[model samples]
Target: MVNSKIQAAEENLIHVYNRFPIALEYGDGMYLYDTEGKEYLDFAAGFAVCGLGYNNKELNEALKAQIDKICHISNLYYHVNCGEAAKELNRISGMDRVFFTNSGSEANEGALKAARRYAYTKKTGRFEFIAMEHSFHGRSFGAVSVTGHEAYREPFEPVLPGVRFAEFNNLDSVKALVNEKTCAIILEPLQGEGGIHPAKQEFMEGIRKICDENGILMICDEVQCGMGRTGSMFAWQDFGVKPDILTMAKAIGNGIPVGAFAMTQEVADFSLKPGDHGATYGGNPLSCAAVKKVIEIFEREDIVGHVKKTAPYLEKRLEEVAGEFEFVTGRRGKGFMQGLVFSRPVSEINLKTIEEGLLVIQAQGNVIRFLPPLIAEEKHIDEMIEKLRRALRKLQ
Candidate 1:
């Protein structure tokens, strides 16, 4: 049964999302409490956005302090935290310039624009892009255009022109799509919505070589797999192949609704100028404060190191869970981003897990994607697996 809060929300808001019945009230540590005060062990971590977890005292204090100082000041003037945030992002990402956006979709949009603008500036007459198959970028017009999912692009019939789909982790497929008009290749190093498939090291190096040979820009969409989610500062760092353009969001601000697209010095010099792209609330003081604090916390606490230490345990526990379930076919992913493949539709199983006091989410290919908080420990993994086991038993 839906609670009063959920009912009220449904009545007022557009029915775009088929939301769950439970109305989340608040969170403490890795657990979320509903309106009726039922506790749930969160494995989704708000779709991997809450890296620091819920109600973190230090993060909260940083946000509260920002509120006390000032919140929204337009980008016309400089704010205290924006430059600091950008510097930290560049320092961590190894990108030369950063442009902040409100969400991953916008970051991707800016990235697409940057890639095209780079070609335009160079007078290369190359505007086409090659994106990976089964990849999910975002829902915006340009992001959806190169998304590579026909269902997503079908309704939006006329997407950005000159874009082609390529088989992910297949260098030949990407090479086949490249031409004189091909300006960029965009892919997620570790695909999140496409079933947690990590790109092979050789495949990554091959793409870099192809881009270098063809003079095509490489863009890595790290919106889901970045910011310590993959036990690296960015997923691409795992492969040691740097991209000309990189997009990041999700855990960047630890839940502050901010995203960014960064580029190397070469790309920055040739791409999107002041008149080409602008976001009004993109780098607002409030969001920058969150970004600044999140990065500072990540550095001070060595969150990436923690993920590296804890990920093996997570993988081991998930393997056990997969072995226990007859329907579960396999387990795959990197660090905190893991998935369990099932033979049957996982929608019912997801609902059942929630009933068993756990929260998880699904990806394509009947995948039960596990994007637990970076703060998750071995104990949390044990509890998550046990709760999931209970849910699976109920289904049986």
Candidate 2:
């Protein structure tokens, strides 16, 4: 039965999201069942946030246990779980320090502030940041300022000044935009919302070189591409390029709200003095406990290895389906974060796929994004592909 509450929602609530006309009740594994008891294969994975899949036992248990112990504690006092989570994050990321936030945008905000502060310390008048075109940072003022999408930033005109845009996957464009006045250059190793465009190897190396030569801090926003989503623990590691600072969120806590920014000791030293930045709910005990368990599960299950082994199979299946559809232009991206570009708009296809009992997301440039949970089995992949095939046939 469709809930009357949902219908009421459409009438009363703000229509921020033109959401699919279905109310999700619960989910298990890679499947979400709607209020009407209809099952749908979940390939979007809650916009790439639910890494362990729906209603994961371990993650649920961790949350339940934490709920009994403690839920929220301000950063005014030392918290055990938050401290431990920071240590673990530093260990995993090979960074000296970690500052936690509640979302990816907040983490990026911290990174931007830190970059500006670092520049201030060096007596460098550089305050500008060079971001890639089509990049999708969060909706916060600082994040949207650096984001490349005009649609998202159009309404909120008069954003922060000194943000310059460069072309994604184009190193020369980045080189041309970055100068001594540039304090930082931020990019996603794999562009997510903009489209699943992986940074070319040469481009990755080139950005690092530019940062090195210009003394600019290289900030990699791994909010969507990190946390074992891209076969590797960090996507930057895959290209053998390191950043002075890195921001992460999404799957970090396995759906628990937690985000972090890490930086080298030197970079963290400048601009981020005591009381420089803080979050009210950041680094809370409950979120940190979830993050700890998430990391443990990743290590014990070898989730990264699983993604590497299975991604090619998933990609092959997607490619095969693409070949059958005349609308499919090409496929791009890395590991589990793949995109199928189509000659036509994908919004109709996305809606139709939902009706066919599958859930996926449409990216910019008319691409259908596939970000299944890293723990998903081959059976789930096959199910998703089958649904996609059915949707394609209907579209044709």
> Which candidate number has the best lDDT?
1
Writing each residue's lDDT as its tens digit, candidate 2 over 1-396 gives 657869888889898897878898999988899888999989998888888887878888988999999899767789899889999888877788899999999999999999999999889999999999999889999999999999998899999999999999888888888777999999999999998999889999999999999899999999999989899999988899989999999899878889999999989777688778989899999999999999998889999999999999999998898798889989998998999999998999988899899999999999999999898888888988888999888989
Q: After the best TM-score superposition of candidate 2, give how far the Cα of residue 186 lies from its true spot, in angstroms.
A: 0.4
Whole-structure CA lDDT of model 2: 0.91
* Candidate 2: regions farther than 4 A off: 1-3
Q: Candidates' TM-scores?
A: 0.99, 0.98
Query: Candidate 1 at residue 65, lDDT?
Result: 90
Clashing pairs in 2: none
Error of 2 at 97 (Å): 0.9
